[model samples]
Target: MIDKDRDTKKLQWNIGTGVHYTLNANWALQADWKYNYHRNTGARDRLWGTRLIYRFGEGNKYI
Candidate 1:
């Protein structure tokens, strides 16, 4: 038995999406995806990530 004015109040939400491809001037490739929602009790989460970029000694000069 526990119910001492329980009202913490909780709400969470998140969404994200990204993609960038530029296989030139050096090398660049990235991909990301994320989605999360937690309302009341219905909890759900999903995340994805991928990245492979490299640039050294002046690579991309606003190209």
Candidate 2:
């Protein structure tokens, strides 16, 4: 059984990036994601997700 009455310090940090496909100058589709790594334990965490981006005016576009 899992401990329901426990206090665990899940201290970690995240640092990552992903490539994206530019559908247009205003819209884009990307595989944007990130990860969390435990600082003290050196254990990797599966803390990542997807994102949708919309831009106004051209600046730094990626594909």
Candidate 3:
């Protein structure tokens, strides 16, 4: 059965976090994670990823 009520409401939310680390004056590392919550559909999704960054010009940086 499907609910056709026009007033029906569904709840959804997303939460995420990310971290950035400086490996050197011109290099960096990044990582991220995220999660999704759906109340009405009872479905969830998760994501994670990592990235490497590089700088073209010199600056007061490095890790």
Candidate 4:
């Protein structure tokens, strides 16, 4: 069955790590790296990706 206008999620391989550094009160910096892989049965079917992220937030929740 298929649903219209509904969000569907697919399975994919992903690995990532992140670190947060606080420069002072009420501010922070975050860095992250990720790898994603997609595979299929065909010989030419392959996908790979990397990602980075920086975020700022308040309080100790950023850690």
Could you estimate the TM-score for every candidate? 0.36, 0.44, 0.69, 0.46
| Number of the predicted model whose TM-score against the real structure is largest | 3
Ten residues in a row with the worst lDDT in model 2? Answer: 1-10
What lDDT does each candidate get?
Answer: 0.87, 0.69, 0.86, 0.53
Stretches of candidate 3 off by over 4 Å are 1-9, 59-63
User: In candidate 4, which residue ranges exceed 4 Å CA deviation?
Assistant: 1-11, 41-63
Model 1 per-residue lDDT tens digits across residues 1-63: 245445566788999999999888788999999999998889998999999999998889787
lDDT of 4 by residue, 1-63 (tens): 456433364445767777766755555567666666653322232344334333445545534
Q: 1 or 3: which has the higher TM-score?
A: 3
For model 1 the TM-score comes to 0.36
lDDT of 3: 0.86
Model 4 TM-score?
0.46
Ranking by TM-score: 3, 4, 2, 1
For candidate 4, the 10 contiguous residues with the lowest summed lDDT are: 39-48
Q: Please provide, for model 2 over 1-63, each residue's C-alpha lDDT reduced to its tens digit, 9 standing for 90 to 100.
A: 246534454668987888777677777667756787886689886645565778877834653
